[model samples]
Target: MSGIQYLVCLWILLITQSRFVRSDIQFIEKHEGDSVVFPCAIEQRNPAPFGVYLKRSWLVPNEILFMHTGEDFKMKYDHDKSRTIVSGDPINHTLNVTISELTTKDTDRYYCEFIVENPSSEDEHIPGKTEFFLLVTADTPASVDSGRIETCSGGSVVLPCLPAEEGLAVEGVSLKRQKGQEPVEVLYDSRRHHGNEPPSYSQFPAERFRLTSALGPGGITYNLTLQQLQPEDSALYSCQLLQRDRPDSHASLGRRALFVSVKGDDCSCSSSSTLLYALSSAVVVLLLTIVFVGICLCKLRPSVKPNRQAPIYEDMAGFKDLKSSTKLAPNHLEDTVSVYNNTSVKKSCPENHYESPTGALCPRNETQT
Candidate 1:
């Protein structure tokens, strides 16, 4: 046989085999924290072994859920491994997934893919995909609308989750804290044998969390009253409906969260803006006080008085007397020495000299000497 002929025969056989396989979708309706299963089937005439891959998607494809070779089945997304269960064999050509502890974020489309590698072919693996859409309904009626609730410390507030559905009897409800992707801290359960609290709620304030049944527009509304609200009481609270017969069934009707920004009563921490304002005011007052004290000190300080000067005429008279006294001292010594030596002396005074009242050298005579 020729090589071209063998390739043509293989191509025809693969085309014929691909026509026999088909994928199908299954629908599911569940509530939060309830386990739900999805079934996918692939039927073919040839029961040859194939690989299987499962993935979940919202608007875009997300994490891989399960992957199967001919012998082993492995969970591709390890974080969600504990919650996902996959079963069925290649011979059965079916895949079933049971997802436990569902949340609102889990509502998405799941894809079951069957892949086959053609014999002796290095090309891309042939894939066939089946899609399943999951619809998770809230346990409460759709009309009840409440989001985040804010309250102050030492005050009382109500977190209401009213079911608007008129005919459905209220079997039970579970109130819990939504811990990220799952629920944590069971606050209340109507189905529990010991009132509404579980053993996990021993540390929780039993008296502060009260259940109130009242009549509203939808007839009877259930509210969880929170008293003595502190900052620590802030969290996302979930109100889930429980089935009487199937006590394991948990679904959220609505969520009411608390944002406790209390003013006082142990919540004494002030806002950042208030702290900034106080610090700024203190700084301004300190600067102003310093300036005022400096001004007062300057005003109260003693002044330095300068020494007074003599009158101009008195100063001139004193200068003239100082000169005359200095000159007369020398002249008197000279006259004494002349008399002792017995010298015949001429008049010591110049011919044109005159004495003024101050007795200083006058340069020339005012009157004749």
Candidate 2:
């Protein structure tokens, strides 16, 4: 056959054998191994299509996981093939996905599209289109609502996870540490024993760590305490909802990655220091408040008050006694002073010492003192 005939035949073969459809995870929920349905509507939600193919590309990670284009491609990505199972007859166009084992390295923006016909060399060949973001969180010091991660070589590290919302009856909790390709389970709890639940406990993954339930102010808080942490413990930690059905971690809600710089043999945290700092801050604030109050008092002046020592010299009130030789008394007057001078004044020179009219001494006899 001529090259042209051969090329045309190959195109026809791929397009015919390989069907295409669309798929994508709904919701913006970001996590690893989250099952998101990639819709492959046959005719924009009408009748499902007859041909379907699943192809996904991760831009940030720069990896392409396309459907096996050929037998060689299938062999290279066989695991992916088994992991990916489709539902709904292609003739009807519906697909569901279940990615079991998820990793932190799965952080990437994904696009899943289908081809109506391969090598169509035409516009109608493109099938369905959808995309999703998978933020594969690390499994290190895991918590539902991860707060902060701090680590020292042989010291202590605390990983706090905050749940999406409060009031979730977390039945059990588990913490897993992933180093290289190996995941070491550090903490496990069989029963949270919240409300009226009974307590359950066990041992696994040696004795590096243990999970315990404690009644905290934060409400039945679950904790995984590790003593004498090892250097190899440094890894991406994750907290998973403890479940027995699949006996596998559900989805990780929180994560943190940290490097430990071990120094000597001291691996314990200094809660005392934190407390001391807090106490000192409180004391300083209290002192400042007291000082502020004192300053305000000092700056505020008092209004002037009437003096009790001042004599009450008021004018005589109305309806005074005007006849008697006695002076009139005021009804409300506290005190009265009307003094009468005994010494009398004489004219400059009483004329020739006029006969005394019960009064004057002549100036001739009077001396100006």
Candidate 3:
């Protein structure tokens, strides 16, 4: 081949051999004393790959945590050897590194690299790589005394933002919410300004979050109000007070933390109240039913009317023959005479013997004697 054609052919070969691929960044968040696993996938190749490496890439000199060579695995750092484990599965084409008992110092960006020997050149080429960022947060003593608020969905609630230490001049306030894996900035208000300049205010969602301040005897009280709450709004809210250290500098004066719990609209208390109302209505209905039944029974029953007329003695002589009857004779005779003389019965018996001048017991007895 000619010298120029050989140079062109070699250039084409190098261009075809060297290739690069970049993946999107992944972010992870965790608490202190927790464990995390970084799973890296091995690129499939015809021959078994040469080696793998896990390193912290954000530092000036990349720190290698784990390395895999031909049939062997090792940890480079002595401090990490106790808490880190590196393993790989050749068949599944995966390399996994796990770190336990993590601390805030372990928070950094990491990358996994897979190297393969290039047959054409002496150098090794990275065929596969992945990167991720991890964040670890530690709990402070003040978090133990954080305030907690609970509210229902679609309702509004206010989170108080008072200085931890009193009598400090606060120039600004910032509120943040920590949900699952990220801390979101809710709002910020700057109270400091130059002459004739207005204060500054900013918020993530202006419609949902509002920051209001009130002047009181103690100092200015800043409150953050959340409207139309949802389940996702339940989170740990942090408030920081900013004070002007100098004309061009500001520092945090104090921090206060609050946790909020948002429930569904049909909360337990509302359900209980509804149940109690239903029971009360049922009781009232039952009482009304009983009263109605009693009234029906009273109206439906048959009534008895007194006769009002005295019963006349059929055998006056028989009554006089008995000794016990003699004592009742006067009252009985007076009752009989009063009944016989009644205007209502006088028409039927116009002249009764009890009312006769001859004093005969009865007309039939007088005729017989």
What C-alpha lDDT do the candidate models reach, one value each?
Answer: 0.56, 0.44, 0.61
Candidate 1: tens digits of C-alpha lDDT, residues 216-276 = 6857777777688665555456564444444433333344433222335422333443465
Cα lDDT tens digits for candidate 3, 1-369: 854455456555544543322444566656688899988776677555566777775422375554545465677767677888777743345778899998767766677766666688773545245666665667643342345566888777887776655676777766777544445655566766633435655554678877788998877888878888886676667766555663421222125555666767555566565566566557655666676788789999999897775445636545644644454456455434355556433222233334552334434435345
> Which parts of model 3 are misplaced by more than 4 Å?
1-31, 34-137, 191-204, 215-217, 246-254, 268-369
Q: What TM-score number comes out for model 1? A: 0.32
Model 3: how far residue 203 lies from native, Å: 4.6
- Candidate 1 or 3, higher TM-score? 3
- Positional deviation of residue 176's Cα in model 1 after best superposition, in angstroms: 24
Over the full model, what C-alpha lDDT does candidate 3 score relative to the true structure? 0.61
Cα deviation of 14 in candidate 2 (Å)? 36
Which residue pairs collide in model 1, if any?
32-251, 139-253, 140-253
Error of 1 at 106 (Å): 1.2
Give one clash count per candidate, in the order shown: 3, 24, 0
lDDT of 2 at 344: 47
The C-alpha RMSD in Å for every predicted model, in order, reads 25.8, 26.4, 28.0
| Model 2 stretches with alpha carbons more than 4 Å out | 1-39, 45-50, 59-76, 117-129, 140-369
Positional deviation of 363 in candidate 3, in angstroms? 22
